[model samples]
Target: MNKLQIKYIRQMLGLSQQELGHLIGVHNSLISKIETGTANLQPKTEQAIITLFSEKGISDNDATVINALLEKRKAV
Candidate 1:
């Protein structure tokens, strides 16, 4: 996921960065860094996020729709 998508999904799920980090077994600072685009999402981290989405019943199509909305919002 891109930074914007990550941020959007977290917000949609009403999760703070710390909460997501805890769920994904990562440091909160890493989550911050990711959202800020200063760090890359590691393979394991991405997988964890995907797993989390699966558990939450958030499909890739949902993510795609969010991405499109975000891009459209940016255009606005």
Candidate 2:
């Protein structure tokens, strides 16, 4: 997923960057960097976000869109 999507999802889940990072086993700065476009997410990290949101009962449409976006980025 892209930076905005990441931030949006976190917000939707009522999580701060630090909290999301902690849940995903990363430092908060990493989350910040990702959000600011200073860094890119690894595939594993993206998958972790997806899995976490899925567990939190995010809509299937949102998940599908995220996966599609990730795939499009991979193709670029």
Candidate 3:
């Protein structure tokens, strides 16, 4: 997942980094680094994130678009 996607999904889920990290089996610091675009996530982590979005009725394409929108919001 891209940084934008990660940040948006976490926000949409109403989850703090520690909460998200607990759900995904990662450290809170790792989640922070990822959201900050300072970390490259492993493929397995990406797959898990994708699955989570899919369960939330977010298609892969929609996820991408949402990520783009979130990035635009961050830029503004």
The candidate that achieves the highest TM-score relative to the unseen native structure: 1
For residues 28-66, could you state the per-residue lDDT of candidate 3 as single tens digits?
999899888788888988887788768777788988789
RMSD of each: 0.9, 5.0, 1.9
| Model 3 spans with C-alpha error above 4 angstroms | 71-76
The residue-by-residue lDDT of candidate 1 on 4-73, one tens digit each, is 9989899889889999999999999999999999999998998898789768777999988889999999
Candidates 2 and 3 compared: the better one by lDDT is 2
lDDT of 2 by residue, 1-76 (tens): 6787788778878999999999989999999999999998899998888788888887669866866776787799
Better of 1 and 3 by TM-score: 1
Candidate 3 — what's its lDDT? 0.82
lDDT of 3 at 58: 78
- The TM-score between candidate 3 and the true structure equals 0.80
Q: For residue 6, give model 2's deviation from the true position in Å.
A: 0.7
Off by over 4 Å in 2: 63-76
Q: Report lDDT per candidate.
A: 0.90, 0.84, 0.82
Clashing pairs in 3: none
Give the TM-score comparing model 2 with the true structure, all chains together: 0.77
